[model samples]
Each structure stands twice: as C-alpha cells, then as structure tokens.
Target chain A: MSHIRIDNLTKVYMGRRSRPRNIHDPEEHFGDNILVLNDITLGFEEGEMVCILGPSGCGKSTLLRIIAGFEPPTNGTVRVGGQVVSAPSDQSIFVFQQGGLFPWMTVYENVGLGLRHIRDAATKHERIQEYVEMVELEAFEDYYPHQLSGGMQRRVELARALAVNPDLLIMDEPFSGLDFLTHMKMREEVVNMHEFLRKTTLVVTHDIDDALIMGDRIVVLSGRPSAVKLMHALNFPRPRDFEKNPGLSRLRSEIFLMLGVPYAV
Target chain B: MKQHNDGEPTMKDNPEQAPDSGNRSLRLGLLSLLVIILLWEVLARGTGWSVHIFPDPLTVVFSFVELLRDGTLLRHTVASLFRVTAGFYLAVCLGVPIGIVLGRSVNARSLFNPIIQFLRPISPLAWIPLAMLWFGIGDPPAIFLIFLASFFPMVVSTTIAVQNINPTYFQVAANFRFSYQETLTRLILPAIIPDVVTALRMTVTIAWLVVVAAEMIAVQSGLGYLILDARNALRMDYVMNGMIVIGVIGLLLDNIMKRLGDVESSKWGIQAR
Candidate 1:
C-alpha cells in the first residue's frame, strides 16, 4: 500500500461563480461547470520526494490541494496511511507559494505554532529553535516576516511547516517569485532537507530541470481536464548534471518535446 | 556649487540632518501660531467691533486663568471626560466583537448588515429626543447619545478590517490546528489591531463631538454647559476659553490614539494599509 494514494481523482468545478474562466479546453465546459482534473490516479511512497510538473494553470495545484485536503475532489478519494483525507490537518502541512507567514508574528512564534500543543515550555522552545536552525535562520528568530527578504520569508515558512513533523509536506510553486540565485538556493535547501528528513514530500513546479534534479519520481500532468502525461522514476544519482550525464540530457530533451516545446536547448 | 553642497554631506551626514529637519518644523509651527495670534490681536483692537462680541486673545487668556484658578475648567472637563469614556468603552466592548462576528460569518453579516446600514446613516443628534425620553436628562442620556454616535462607526470599520484580513492566514491557522479561541486571539485580533486603532481614533473624535452637543441639551456639568452658561451671561471670553480647552483635549486624544498604531505587533498592519 502506498503512503498516499490518490485514486481515480476527478474534480469538476460546478456553479456559475465557482467555474474558473481559465479553462484551456472549451469542449469540457458545460453550462455553469468546468472540468479541472479527469481520472487522475497516482500514489506516493513513504519518504518519497515526488515533483509534479505541468503546463501553467494545468490543475497541478488543484491536485496538490486535494492531496493536502485543502479542497475536496468532486469524485474519487485521497487516502493517507489507510485514512481518508477530508480536511486540512496537522498530519499534512501545506506551504503556500509566498507570504503565508503571519505578518504579526516573529519567526520564532511562527515556527512555534506547531509546538503550541506541547505543554512543556522548554521542549517547545527547543523544537522551535531546532527547526529554525534547520533552515539556517537562528540569527533571525526575533524578526517578523515582513522584515525579512523574499527568500528568508520562504525559509521561515519552511521552518514553520517542518516544525510540526508532518507525515507529508506539500509545496505549491514554492520558488515562483524569488530571484534567480535565491530560487536556486531555496531549491537546493529543499532538496537537502528532503534528503535529511526523507518525508513524503510533493512539490508542484513548472520547471522541468527542477523536477529532474529534485524529484525521486517525476510526474508530468497535461493541460485542463488534466490527466497523467508521464510518471518516471529518476534513478539518476545525486548531483545530477545534464551536461555531464548523457542520459539526463536525453531525458530532459524528451520531456521538453513531450510538453510540446520544439527543442530542449 | 550644488554638487559641492551635496558632496559635503555624504551618507555619514544624513542621520544628523534628520533631527535638524525635525527641529526646523517645530520652530516653523510655533512661528505660525504666533502670527495667527498677532493677526487676531490686531483685528480685535482695530476693528472697533464690540469687545463683548469678539473678545481679544489677552482677555480670553485672563478668563482662562480665572477658570483654571477656580477649578471650574477642571470640573467641567472631568465631567465631559467621564461621559465620553463611559460611552466609548461601552461601544467598543460590544461593537468590536459584533464586528468580528459579522466579518467572519456570512450568515451574521447577512442578518445584521442591513439593519446596521439603515441605522448608521441616521445622525446621533437625531436620537437626542428619543434618548432624553428614554433616559430622562442626565449622564445616562448624554452617555447614551455618545454611545450611539460612536458605536456604528466602530462596528463598520472593524467589520471592514476583519473582512480585509488575508484569507491565507486563516488557512495557515487551520493547517496548524489552531482552536477557535486561538484563531480569534492569535489570528483575528492581531490582524485587526492597527485598523482597530485607526477606527478607535476616528470614533473617539465623533464621540467627543457628540459629548459637547449632548451636554448642551441633556447634561449640566460639561464643557458644553460651560460655553452655554457663559453665553447666557454675555461672557464671550469664557466661551472662547471653553473652545480652547476642547480643541487642546481633542488634539491630545488624537496623538495618543496615533501612538497605538506604532506599537511593534500592530505596525505591520499599519504599514500594509
């Protein structure tokens, strides 16, 4: 049995107001209804780092949101460890794209949110400090989210999420608004953290190279009324380099072609 | 020459210039006040208008001293302060929580918003007759009028503030398993503090405005009564004294309320606005 199983997931947004106008397929639009995801079945193994890639606005986030239990699927079910996922729980934490850290709370307080259940003060403080240090933000424990840079804010959010020791960590377009260098650094940090923790991590991204470099298994999703386009396990060793490795280079070109891009380079 | 002037003060000199600019503004403000007093003195003495109708600044200052010496000013000011405090506190206690409820729950907003909107436009002064009839002329009636003046604005502003809070924070709160009480205390309250402070500042001003009006009709021992009493006695200087005191106190209240938005936890909300 998989650690997380998304079985035959189908999400159709109903009602006039609920229907999004960003539908790529006009054929799928019925009156006051639009289909988002269609019969998508996938499973994530325990401690597996899965990167989901798709075209922009291709319902990748909807799928991730469903898995994290932020939104319900119109049909089909998402189960985690034999339990059906229904509502957002501390067992699975979702890190938003950006600016999710409470503006009013300092980094220490934000990270301590998960540890709020612990009655012992010293233990809670220790847990907060441990996660803060994990993200290399020990010097900024007292700083508020708005005081930090974009990358540092993301780090604080990451620390806040990881502090809970959730069984599954889901990130949606985590590096979208960051600068080039900051984005690469954050990507490296996430990969390193996943390597150390080996938690069931699902990352939704648009960058193919990011999926190739970070994912233990990479799943590509197609456009609206999305279904699984490809799911391949990347057994390529760590420090994967497309330039140095011919196989990775070939796979990158294949994925680019699969996504309808003419050439990789 | 301009380049040389700029070159003299590099980054090292910028900090020194900040306080210099502040001191300059303070001096200019005082000078402006002096000019206004001078203009008023010239107009009062040269216009040949009845001194009874428009007393000179010197005469008003003398009356101000007399009122202070007799403690009449203190007593009246205290009385007015008491009514405003009682009514404003009552409104805040009830209005803020109701506002949060309306902001959070669609059902509560739907049920209450129309009634609030209908009542909000009707002036607090319009309630003067009803308030006198109900509470019958004293601190109760005056305070009731002030409460009416401040309550609707407090509720409306707070509701807007809470509704404007980022929906992402609620999602974060749920993801962390924040209990209902924790959500209110840790999320809702802090998120709205800066806005609440601003609402409070404006509402307190309205309450102060109504306090004087309410006192002119309903009560006997406030600054408003002092002005009315002075008017009947044909002592224009005393009336001017009452106006000065009210203006000073209003300024002080505004400054204090402004400081609330500067507090560390609330500053984020202020800056976002």
Candidate 2:
C-alpha cells in the first residue's frame, strides 16, 4: 500500500445562491452547487516529494486540504498508513500558503507550538531551538511574524511545521508570495529538507520550473472540476538545470503547452 | 522653507520625522488650550453676571483649590474611579467569555445576538429607575448602571474581534493538535487582545460617562453628585471644578487604555510598529 492514498476523491461545494454561468466552465453549476473536484485518485509513496501543479482555482489546494483532513471529501477516502483520515492531526502537518505564524507569538513561541505536548520544558526548548536553527532563524527567535519579512515568516512557518516531526508534510503554495531570490532560495531549502528528512512531502505550486526542479514526481491537474491530467516522474539528479538537461527542458516546455501558455522564451 | 520641510520627507524618512511633527503638534495643542482659556475668561467677565451664576476661570480655579483643600474633590474623584473600575472589570469578566462563545458558535450567536442588540441601544440612563428599584439607592445601582452602559459594547466589540481573527490561525491550531484549553488561551484569547483592549478603552469611557449620571440619580458621592450638590448650593465655580476633575480623570483613563494597546504582543496585526 502507498504511504498515503487518495482514492476517487470528489468535492462539491454547496453554494448559497446561483452564480452567473462561468463561460469557461459551462457544466459546473447544478442547482446552486458547484462541482470542484472530480474523481481525483492519487497515491504517495513514502520519502517521495510530489508537486501538484495546476491552473489557478483548480482546487489543488482544496485537494491538499482534504488530504490533510482539514476538510472532508464529498466522495471517496484518503487513507494514511492504512488508517482512514478523518481530521487534522500531528501526523500530517500543513504549511499554509499565506503566512500562518501567529502574529502574537514570537518565532520561538510559534515553533514551540509543535512541542507543546512535551512534558519536559528543557526538551521542548531544545527541540524548538533545533527547528529554529534548521530554518536559520536562531537570531530572530524573539521576533513576531509581522516584524519579519515575507521570506523570514515562511521560514518560521516551515520551522513550526518541521518541529512537529510529522510523517507527512503538506504545503499549499508555500513560496507563492516570496520575491524571486527568496523564492529560489526557499525552493532549494524545501528540496534539501525533503532530501534530508525523506518525509512524504506534497507541495502545490503554479510555477512549472518549481515542479520540475523540486518534485521527485510531478502531478499536473487540469482546470475547474479538475482531474489529474499528467503524472511524470523526474528521476533527475540534484541541481537540475534546464540548460544542461534536454529531457528536463523538453518537459518544461511541454508543461507550458499543456497549460495553454506559449513557451515564447 | 515650511513647504520644503513638509514635502521633502519621503516614506523612508517617516520614522525620523515622527518626533519633529509630534513636537510641533504638542506646541500647537498648548497654543489652542491657551486660546480656549482666554475665550472662556473673556466670556465670563463680559457676562456681568455674579460669580455664582457665571464664575470666571479665576473663581473656578479658587473653588478648585478650596475643594482640593477640603478633600471633597479627591474623595469624589476616588469614588468615581472606584465605580468605573468595578463596573468595567465586571463587564470584561462576563462580556469577553460570552463574546467568544457567540463568535465561535453559530447557534449561540443566532440565539443571543438579537436579544443583545435590542438591549444594547436602550440607554443605561433609561435603566436608572429599574436599577434603583432592584438594587435600591446605593453603589450597587450606580455600579449596575455603569455595567449596563459598558457591557454591550464590550460584548459586541469582542465578538467582532474574535470573528475577525484569521481563520487560518484556528486551522494552524488544529493542525498542531492544540487542545480545547490551549486553543482558548493560546489562540483565541491572544488573537482577541488587541481588539479587546480597544473595546475596553471605548467602553471605559462609556462607563465613566454613565457613572456620573448614575451618581446623580442613585448615589450621592461621585463627581456627578458633587456637581448636583453644588448646583443646589448655587455654586457655579464648584460645578466647574467637578467638570474639570471629571475631564482630567477621563483623559487619564483613556491614556492608560492606550498604553494597554501599546503592549508588544497586542500591537500585532493592529499597527505597523
């Protein structure tokens, strides 16, 4: 059995009122209910980094949320290590797309949240320090989320999630709001972290390059009422570069074509 | 030169420029106070009425010293402060928990929201007759009136604050397996502190306003009673002295609440600093 299995997952959001017909999604609405996910069946192997890529509003995050047990699937089941997922738990920690570090808490306090169950104060402090150091945020342990820059806040969140030592790590567009340099750096850090920890990590991203470089395997999802369009394994070695690898370059362009974006560059 | 100074400071320079502008405003504020006092003195003298009817600022000052010397001013001020503190604490203790419940539970909100709204706007002054009937003429009725005046705003503001908390924070709390108690203390309470402090600041003012009125009706020791008793004696200067004390105390209460807002953790998500 796979480490995590999402079988025939479907989500239907009950709308409050009738929405105007979306020209692109003509078949979406049926009596004030919008079909969001249509039969999303996927599996994750232990120690594999899977990147879910899709167009905006494709319900990729919704799928991630379901897998994390933050929301229930309208149909089908997500089983983790042979147990059915019913609610959010420490076994699967989700790093939110937006800044989720508690605004009121210092970085040390936020990271300490994962270790709150530990009875030994010294042990909890040590673990928090370890995670903070892993994120290279030891100097900012006393800083609040709002006091940090966008990239630093993401690091705090990453530290907080990693401090949980979860079996499954799920991130929803974790580096979405970062600047270009910070985005590249965070991508490298996430890939390195995955390599080091070998946790079953799943990330949702809009950037194709991010998927190609960081994912051990990439799952492409189609637009509204989204279904998995393509699933490809990268098997490429670390420090993957489109310039040096013809296969990676071809795959990158292919993704752009599949997403209906011209590979003009 | 003035235009140059005002226009040259860029966004990056705002921190450095803050103190200069703050100093200028303070000077302007003092100038405005002086002008207002001068206008009041002119009006007092021009009225040609006896000091009992329209006392000049000097007579009011003298009466302030006399009231101070006799200790009535201090006694009345302390009385008023005690009532405000008692009533304010009572409202906070009851209102915040109720607000949290209303905010978190849709059922509770639907059940109690309408009743709260209906009671909220009925002036505490209007409740004086009922309060006196229930508690009799003493501190209880006056305190009850202050509680009524402040409670609704506290509940409403706290409820809104809790509701306004980023849903993401609760999800984060859940992901980390935060227990019910931890969620309340660590997540819900701290998240609401900034807004609650602001609500307290506003509610305390409302409470202060009601205490005076409450004292006028149900009690005879607060600044409001002092004002009423002075009016009976036809002592306009004493009335002005009571007004001045009330205003100064009100200003002090607001400043203290503002300091609560400036606490490091509570300033989060509320302001840049």
Candidate 3:
C-alpha cells in the first residue's frame, strides 16, 4: 500500500517581470512561464526510505516541497496516507537545506517545541531527551543554536523534526556543506534513527554518495523540466559502509552517464 | 553598538562567561568615577572659582548628604521613578504589539512609515504645552511626555525585527501545527528580543531624559524641580547635588536594564543572535 502518491505533478515558475500577477495589469501581461518539474509521479510504501537524486537546477527540492505540501503543483495531485495533501500538516515534517533552528531557543527547547502538544510534560520531556541524546547532543541541551557547530545545529533540526513523531520526513539537501567526516557521522545517525523509528523518509540530494549511503531506493532525475530518468534498488546489504565498498564507484559512473556529466575519478 | 547582549565568549581567555565581564566593568566604572571627582576637585581649587559658581566636589557631596538626611531626595526620587515607570510600561504594552502587526504586513508598513517618520522626529518635549492643557500639571503630563519618548523606538525596532525574520521559521511552525498564540509568544517574541532589548535601553534613557524636561516645565517635585529650585535660591551646591543625583540614577537604571537583558539572553545562548 502506498503511503504517499504523486500523480503527474507539474510546476511552472513565472519569471520575474515576465508576467503580470493578475488580469488587472493587461499591458504587462507576459506569457513566459519556466517549466521546472514535469509529470513527476512517484510513490513510496510505509517505513520505506527513498532518495531522489538530481543535479543542480533540476528542481528536486521543488519536488520535495510539493510533497511536503509547501508548494502546489500546477497539475496533478498528491496523497499522503490516502488523504490528499493540500497544506502542511503535523503528520509530515520538512527539514530545509538550512538547519532552520530557532536562534533564541536552546537545543532542548528547539527539540521540545512540538512535543508540548503531546499533552504531558513528563512524557514530552522524556521524548525530547530521547531524541536529543539520539543525536548525541545531550551535553549541549541548554546551549543555543549559535553556540553549537554547524553539524550540531543540523542535529538539533533533526531532533526537532523527530520529536514531533511525524509519519513522513522530507529532507532537502539537509547536509549540504558539512565536512566529509561529519557528513558520514550524520548519515550513519540518520540511518540508525530511521531503523529505530521506522518512519517513511524521502531525501532529495545532488550528492551521489548521499543517496548511496542511506537510501533503500534511488530515483534519478534529469535537468530542468526534470522527470524521473531512472530508479535503482541497491543489491548491497543494510547500512553498507561506502568508504570500503568496492561496488559503489560503478554505480556512481552509471548515474553520471545518465546525468550527461563527464565521469570524474 | 548593541551592547545589551548575552555576554558571551567575546574575550577568549575568560571562558567563565558573564561573571568576569560584569565584575570587571563594575570595577572600571568605580575607578572612573573616583578619577572624575578628583579632577573636578583639583580644577575648582586650582582655578580659585567662586563657591557659588563652581561649587567644588566636596560641596556637591555635602549637599547630597544634607538632602539624604532631610528625606527630600527620597521623595523626589520616588516621584520621578513613578512617572517614568508608568510611562515606559505603557509604551511597551502599546508599542510591541503594534510593531509586530505592522511588521507582518509590508503594505501596512509602507503606508504608515511616512506618518511614523513625521511624528518620530517631533521631540517629546515639544508636546509639553499640549500635554499640560490635556492632562494638567503634576504626574500625568510628565508621564505622557515619557511615554511619547519611549514608544517610538519600541515600535520601530519590533517592526524591523518581525520584518527581517527568516521565512523558514514560519514553515517549521506550520509543520508543527502551532497556534497563532504559540507562534507569537514562543517564536516571534523570542526572535525579536535581542533587537527589542537593545532598543529598550535607548528608550529608557530617552524616557529618563524627558522626565527631567517635563518635570522642569509641566510638573513639580522631582530631581528637575530640585535643580531649578536650588538655582533660584543661589544654592549652587544644591543644584550641583541634583545634577549629580540625575547622572548617578541614570547610570544605575541603565545598568539594571542591561543586566536584566543579559540574564534573559543567556538562557537562550546570546552568541547565536
């Protein structure tokens, strides 16, 4: 049974000054709409981890937004758990490219934000502590977002998202600029957290290794006006260590060729 | 420029956080005060100026002691404190919400900015004659002037704070299904505190300054009245004492505000702002 379904989704962006916003400005009415995503129909089952792999300017993030209910597609409908998603809901959480941690809140407060709705302070506190410790930020619970390293801030974001106990976690390049070591550590953390929670997760990333490390299934997307070009299931085992895996490079090249980029390394 | 901060690790060697910085500042301030008094004493003695005109530091000290003994200083201080407190509190109550509302709507801000700009520059003192006619002489007119002084900055800073908020915050808030009340009290208020508290110090200073001017004209029985009455009687030392009291009180109030802001900011980690 599909938990999320997108049927023939299409997004067209109006260029700046290219078109009038309303019919009142008839003289300024221009008809130049740039197509970003075309016929993007995809679905995933319960507890499945899916990664959408695409290059820059390919609108993968836009597609994630459409699923997160932050954006509306010009065509096609999206359903989450048999219900159409027209607006953002507590059932789905989106982690932005930026960590988006509230600067004025301590790590504990940031993580505990949504848990207040749980209606029991003791239970909420326990859940917050659980998620914060899961991300290895137990020591910095009282510290604010600015006091932590960039990676730690991202963990706070992750912790906050998880605290809500959402059914769907939509990530858009959540680890864009971290050093490789932190990236690997965080990826492992995400994998472990997913295993622990078994939430349906969808991550959109341009980094090929990001897709390979945590994704159960990878959906490749082409450039602008992008549609799914390929979908591959890894034959490798769970939590495979890509640093030592010999089979990873061949898959990387395959994706590169599909993306029309010259293979490097 | 915005010094009312969480007092973070700006000084690398002192990783002990707030206690060290606050102590050092207090020590430095006391030393500077002693040095200034010594300079005044020497200059008054060296110049051989008249006691009535250039009353020495000792005279000011003696006059302050005398006022303290008679209990007039307490009465005047309480009167002034009451006016400024009522006025500033009212301003905060009125200004912050209005600013947040205007901040949410850009069209509203643009529409109102010209009116705000026009009214902002008109000195609160300029309203005294009108305030006197409306509220009459005593605490009301002085409080009104102080209110005018503090309200504008609070509104302006809060508006800017709301206007400049990152859009991601709202998206996250939406994701969590927060109520309007939750978004304001938890997210919006905390987000604006750093900016709002910085302006808080400025508004307090302006309020204190206007209270003196308003008291000198529109009201009676305050430090301002003390200064004016002493001058009329040619009691130069008493006038000097009143000036000293105003300066010291202003410094004390400002320190109290900065300390309050620092304490609140530290809870949320000040450096991030």
Candidate 4:
C-alpha cells in the first residue's frame, strides 16, 4: 500500500508591485505571479526510501513541504497513511538542509525535545537514548549545537526526527553542507538507520550521486512549475557498499542524462 | 588529536597565547578608575569652589562612613531596595504573562497596544500626584509609581521578543504535535528567555530610577528623601554624600542583576558575552 500520496499539487506565488498607481486595480499591481509547482502528482510505497532529484528552484523542496504539510498547496491533496494532511502532522518529520538544531539546546535536549510531548517519561528516555546511540551521538549528548560540527549537528537532527518514530521521515538536502568524507559517512549512517527502522522516507536533493546512494527509487523533477520527469526503481540490495557498488556509476550517468546535465565520469 | 570526551576537537591541545587577557582587562579597568579619582581630587583642591559645593572623593567617602556609623545610610538603603524590589516583582508578575499573551494573540495585542502606547509616554514622576491621590503618600504610592515606570518597557520588550522568535522553532514544535500551551511553555518560553533576561535587567534599572524619583515626592524615608532633607538644610556636603550613596547603590544593584542574568543565560548557552 502507498504510505504517502501527493496529487495534483499546485502552488502559485503572487509577487507584489514595485510601485503604486493612482487607480487601484487588483490585477494591475500584482507584479508577476509565478507558478512554482504545477500539478505535481506522486506516491511512495510503505517502507520505501524515495528521493526527489532536480536542479535548484525545481520545486522539489516545495513538493516535499507540501507532503510534510509545512505549506498548503493551491490545489491538491496529500495523504499520509490513508488520511488527508491539512497542516503539519505528527506522522511525518521533516529534516532541513542547515541542521536546524535549536542553538540554545544541548544535543541530548535537542533530541529529546520531540519526546517531551510523550507523557511517559520512561518511554521517552528509552526512545531518546535508542536514537542517540543509533546515530553514534550518545557521547556528545551534552554539547550545544554551536559546539558541534555541521555533520554532527545533522546527525543530531536525524536522531531527533527518528526519536519521534514518525510514520515518515522527509529530508530536504540534509547533507549538502558537509565535506565529502563527512557526507559519505553520514550517507552510510542514514542507510543503516533506514534499513534498521524500515520507516518510509522521502528525500529531496540536487546531488545525483546522493540520490543514487541513498534512494530506493529516484524521481527526477523538471524545472519551475515543476513536474516529475522520471521515476527509477533502483535494484541495489541491502547493506550495499558504495565503494563496491558498480550500478551507482551507471545510475548516476542515467540520472545526469535525464536531468540534461553533462555526465562526468 | 586533542578530543573532547565526545570525540570532538578541543582548544586545550594548543595553549592560547593570550593567557594574560583576563589580568590585562582587570588592570586596565582599575587604572581608569584611579585616573578618574585623581582628576576629581585635583579639581576639588585646585578650583575656587567650596569644599561644600564639590567635596573631594575622600570627603564623600568619609561622610559615607559617618552615615554608616550612625546606621542612617543602611536604613535608607534597605528601605529604597525594598521599595524597588516590591515594585519590580509586581511589575514582572503582571507584565510578563500579559506580554506573552499579547505577543501570541493578535487580537489581544491590537486591543492593548493603543492603551499601552497612550500610557507609556507619561513619565513616572507624572504619576506621583495620582498615586498620592489614590494611595495617600505611603509605600503603596511609592511602589505604584515605580510599577508605572517599569511595567511598560518590560511588557513591550517581552512582547516584541516573543513575537520576533524564529518561526522555525514554532514549526518544530508543531511538527512534534505539541499542544498550544506546551508549545508556549517548552519551546517559546525557553527561546525568549534571553530577551526576557535583558528586559528584566532594564526593568531593574528603570525601577531603581523610578523608586528614587518616587521617594523624592511620595516618601519621607528613602535615599531620595535623605537628599531632599540635606538640600533643605543647605548641608551641601550631606547632599553630595546622599547623591554618592545613590550612585554607588544603583551601580551595585545593576551589577548584581547583570551577574544574575549572566548566570541564567549561561545555563541555556545563550549568554550575551
């Protein structure tokens, strides 16, 4: 069964006028109305890891936000677990690009923030510790976000989301800021977590390699007023090692070709 | 690699070269104070001004000691401190929650903003007559004046702080399925603590100013009253002495509030400096 469904999503951004005229006409001063997402329709199956890939301003993040219920669509419906999403729901957690850990909170506290709503203290503690240990962040639990490196902060954010045990995890370019080595290490950690948790996930990224490495299925989105260009179901097996995986390079080239960007060896 | 217990890098591996930075700041501060005092002493001795008009720092210190010996200074200081504390606490208790509500709710803010703006421009001293008329020249009137002085700024600053918080924090709270009250208590309150602390420090200073001004008009037993009495008697030395006392006490109270704010902010890792 499909765990998440997005149908006919449309978002139009109305721009304001630069100057006011003596006669007021509502449409005259509406400088330029740009459509960001045009009738985007897609679905993800239960326990599947899906990546939405496109260039910047391709509305990939906008579509993810719609699915997360962070933003309302101009026209469409988003269903999670067979229920319509009107606003941000507890069933899905969205991880942002910049590792949005609250700077004021210690890492343990940051990870535990979502669990504060859980009335059962024992369960909250167990859940927090479980995810913290999963992310290998148990030692840095007391450190503040400012004290952590970008990669570590992202790990904390991931742990925070996982601790909530949501039905779906949504990530928007979660590893774009990290150095190459750190990004690779984080990818491995995420893959490991996904395999263990088996929770449905949707990730949006511009990096084709990341799409190939992390996604179970890749959905390429076309530029502004976006729509899905292609959806490829990867046949890579579990515990797949990136260094040893031959299909990654082939898939990367295919994605590059689909995106109409020059393919690099 | 020098690592923290958390396996992160630490600054301890390479010793900081400017190890004497703390000592340097302390020495410079003390030197500045000494220079100011020396200049004051020279002006007092060299000018044709009467010692009564502008007493040397030493004379002021001597008079301070004499007042201390007589216990009048302590009594007045305590009385002023008590008034300021009572008024400030009342303002905070009433102001912060009202501010938070106003900040969070647009209707509440719109309703109260006009009245607050109307009242804010009126000086604390201007409230003296009404306070006297309402409470009849006692501690109540004095405290009321101070409350009028401190409440608006505290409430305004707090409201602004709560309103201006990063929307991302609110989104996070909502994503976590927090109840509205839970969002306010757990996320919003903690996020605004730094701003609240800053406003609180400002409130204390304003309260100090208001209490002194209130004492001059509404009370017969505070530091301000001592200054008024000295002036009435034409004892300029005692007047200078009372002014000095007010200055020193105000500085001490401000320092204490600042240190308390520092401690509170540090716990949240949001310390200003």
For lDDT, the strongest prediction is 1
Which candidate would rank higher by TM-score, 1 or 3?
1
How many backbone clashes are present in model 4? 0
Candidate number with the higher DockQ (3 or 4): 3
- List, residue by residue over A162-191, the lDDT tens digit for candidate 2: 998898999999998899999999999998
Candidate 1 lDDT score at position B218? 88
Tens-place lDDT digits, model 3, residues B1-273:
333342343455355667777666775677798999899999999999999999998878888899999999888888988999999999999999989999988888989888988999999989989999999879999999999999998899889989888989988888888899999987888888877877788889999998888888876799888888888989899888877788888998898888767875634666444
TM-score of 4: 0.86
Model 3 residue B146 CA deviation (Å) reads 0.7
**Per-residue accuracy of model 3 over A46-81 as CA lDDT, tens digit each:** 887888998788899888888888888899999999
Those runs of model 2 whose alpha carbons end farther than 4 Å from true positions after fitting are A17-25, B1-27, B269-273
Indicate the residue-level lDDT of B108 in model 1. 97
lDDT of 1 by residue, B1-273 (tens): 763554454445547777655655665677798999999999999998787898999998998999999999999999999999999999999999999999999999999999999999999999999999999978999999899999999999999999999998998998998899999999999999989999999999999999999999988899999999999999999999999999989988888888876876778633542
Higher-lDDT candidate among 1 and 4?
1
Which whole-number lDDT from 0 to 100 does residue A83 have in model 3?
91
What are the per-model DockQ values? 0.57, 0.56, 0.57, 0.40
Which segments of model 1 are wrong by more than 4 Å?
A: A17-27, B1-21, B268-273
Q: TM-score of model 1's chain A, to 2 decimals?
A: 0.96
| Whole-model lDDT per candidate | 0.91, 0.90, 0.85, 0.82
Alpha carbon deviation, residue B212, candidate 1 (Å): 1.0
Ranking of all predicted structures according to lDDT, beginning with the best and ending with the worst: 1, 2, 3, 4
TM-score of 1: 0.94
What RMSD does each model have against the real structure?
4.0, 4.0, 5.8, 6.6
Model 3 chain A lDDT-worst window of ten: A24-33
